[model samples]
Target: MIRNTRSGWGSISRWFHWILAAAIIGMIGFGWWVNHVPARPDRFFYRSIHADIGYLVLLLMVLRLVWRAANPTPALPADSARWTRVAAGISHAALYLITILVAVLGWAHSGAHAPDYSSFFGWFHVPQFTTPDREAARAYEDRHILFAYVLLALIAVHVIAAAWHHYIRRDRVASRMVASDAGTSR
Candidate 1:
C-alpha cells in the first residue's frame, strides 16, 4: 500500500509535531504577555525562556525534515478535487517555509548576545551561536516578528482546512494525515 506519510508519520514525526506545537503556542502566548512588562533587567527572563523553546523547535524541525526526506508521504486523497489538492500542497509548503524562516530569525536574534541563561527552553546550554552585534540582532528580530505574523495566518488557514475536511468533506483527508489506519479498508 502506498503511504503518503509513513504509517502514522513515524514515532519521531509525531513526537516532533506535538512538541513543536506546544513550544510554538507557549512562546507565542508568553511573548505576547510579557510585552506589557517593564524593560527591567528581569524583563529578559521571559525572553530567555522563549528563546530556549524556539531553539528546540528549530532542532526538531530539522529532524522532522530528515525524516520527511527518508519517508515520502503518499499523495493527498485521490478523490480530492484537483483544486483541493493544490490548495493543500500550497498551504503545507507555506507552513514548511515559515517554520524555517521563524526558527532562523529567532536563533539569530538571540544568538547575538544570549542573556544569563542557557538551554533551548531550559534544557541545555546553547552557546551564543552568532557574534554579538546590535544591527544583526535588530535585523533578525524584524524578520522573526514578520514571519511570526505570516505563520499565524497560515496556521489559521490550516485549521480551517482540517475543519472543512472533517466536518464538510466527510472524507479521510484530515485523518489520513494524523491516523495510521487512515486509508485502511480501502
Candidate 2:
C-alpha cells in the first residue's frame, strides 16, 4: 500500500511522518547547539550544516503537504470526543504551519546575514530573499528561535495524544500509522 486509505496511513505517509518528525526534532537540537557553542573559527561550519538541513526540511515539508492533500487521511476513532478531534486538527495544522514558518525564518536569517549562508551543502546557492543586513538577520533569528520552542511544545502534545490513544483508549488510532496494511482496505 503506497497510498493512504480512509482507515490507515500507507507506507509513504508513515515514512514521511517519521522522517520529517526526526528531521525536525534533530534540526531543533542542532540549532540550539550551534547557538550555544563557544565562538570559534569553525562556528560558521556548524551554521552551514544547520542551514542545509533547514533547506532539506523545507523541501520535505512541501512534499509532505502535497501528499497529504492528495491522499485520504485516517479518521479518528468513532468513540473520540469532539474536543479530541478539534484539538487534533488544530495541532496538526499548527505543526505544519510552524514547521514551514521556522524553515522560512531560518532561510531569511541566512539571506540577511550573507549570501554564503544560503549555500545548500556547497552544491549550489539558494537565492537570497533579503539583502545583507545585520539587524534584520538578528531579528529573524530571534523569531526563528521563538517559533522553534513553540514547535517543540506542539510535538510534545502530539506524542502525548498518540500515547493516550494507544495506552489509555487501547484503540487502533496510533497503530494505524505503525501497523502493516495486512488486513486493511485500500
Candidate 3:
C-alpha cells in the first residue's frame, strides 16, 4: 500500500542480484587469469576458486527463483511494447536457467569422483552427484564451456535491452530491477 518510488530494490532481489553479480564476475576474472599460472597446484587452486564461485552462483540462482516465485516482480513498464516485453521476459529467463545449468554441469564435471565432496574450506561438503569418468568429464566440461558462451550471449542481450530502456527509451525498466525502491514508479 505504501510503496515508495525511489527507495531501494526489494531486499530479496537486491541481495540475490549483488551476490550473484560478484560471484560470476569473480569467476570470469579468475578464469581469464588462470592460464597465466603454470604450476599444477596453482592451476588447481584457480580451478577450485572458479568452481566455488560457480557453486555459489548456482545456489543463489535457486534461491532467487524461489523468491521471485513467492513475491512476483513489479509490473513491466506501462508503455513497453508487447514484443519488447516478451523478448525481455524470454531473455531474462534464459539467462537465469542457462547460468544455473552451466554451473551445475561444471560442478558435476569436476566432482563426479566425489573429490572428497569438497568445498573451499572445511566449511561444508557439496555431495558428489555421480561417479567419475575421464571421458565423461571431458564431454561435460566442453559442454559447460558451450553453456558459458550461450550465457554470455544472453547477458549481452540483457545488457543491450537495459541500455535501450534506460537511454534510448528514457524508461525505468532496468532501474526498477536494480534500484532500491526510491519510489514506486513501477
Candidate 4:
C-alpha cells in the first residue's frame, strides 16, 4: 500500500523510517570519527562531507515530519498497556525533536568555528548565524555531543521496545513497520 492504514505502515512511511534510522545512526558514528581524526588537510574534507550530510539530514527530517503529519499512523496493538502507548508517543516525539536539534547544533558549531565548514558540499555558502568565535564553537560542539549521546540512548530504548513487542508481547507491532501492509485491512 502506498498510504498507511490503521492496521500497518505503508511503503512510504516504512521507507522514511528505515532510511532516517540508518542515516541518523551512520551520522552518529561518522561524526565521532570526524572528531577523533588528527589535524590534517584531509580532515577538512571529512568535515565538509559531515556538514553536507547534516544539511541533508535536516532537510529529510523536515520532509518526514510533514509526511507523518499528513498520513495515518498505524495504531498500536489493542491489548497494549496505557503506559506503553504513552511511552511510545513520548519516545517518538523525542526522536524527532532531538534529531533536529543535533543537526542545528552541528550547523551552529560549524558556523562559529574560526574556519567555518558549513558549506553545502561546496555548492554554496551556508550563512553563519553567529560570529566566528572559538569559544562559542567549542560550547556548541559540547552541547551537540551531549544531545547526541541522549539521542543514542533514546535509539537504544526504541530498539529494545521494538524487540519487546516482537518477542515478548508476540504482537505485530514491530512487523507493522518492517513488513508489507498490502494484506492488512483498514
Clashes of each: 7, 0, 18, 0
Q: State, as a TM-score between 0 and 1, how close model 4 is to the true structure.
A: 0.94
For model 2, residues 1-186, the per-residue Cα lDDT tens digits are 889887888898899999999999999999999999999999999999999999989999999999999998888877779999999999999999999999999999998986458778879988878889999999999999999999999999999998998788877687777865532432
All models, RMSD in angstroms = 3.1, 2.0, 3.2, 1.9
Off by over 4 Å in 3: 1-9, 35-39, 113-117
Residue 21 in candidate 2 has what lDDT?
A: 93
- Candidate 3: minimum summed lDDT over ten consecutive residues — where? 1-10
lDDT for every model?
0.72, 0.89, 0.71, 0.88
Best-to-worst ranking by lDDT:
2, 4, 1, 3
Best candidate according to TM-score? 2
List the candidate 4 regions with Cα displacement exceeding 4 Å.
182-186
lDDT of 4: 0.88
Model 3 lDDT per residue over 19-126, tens place: 876777666567657745776756676677677777778888998888777664666667778998788788878888898888888888877533522575457767
In angstroms, the error of model 2 at 57 is 0.4
Write down the lDDT that model 1 would get: 0.72
What is the Å distance of residue 178 in model 1 from its true position?
4.1
For candidate 1, write residues 1-186 as lDDT tens digits.
Answer: 222353344445556667777777677667667666877887787788777777778888888777777776556655778998789889878987898889777877887653433455555777666777878787888788888878888988988997998788777666655655664423
Worst 10 residues of 2 by lDDT: 177-186
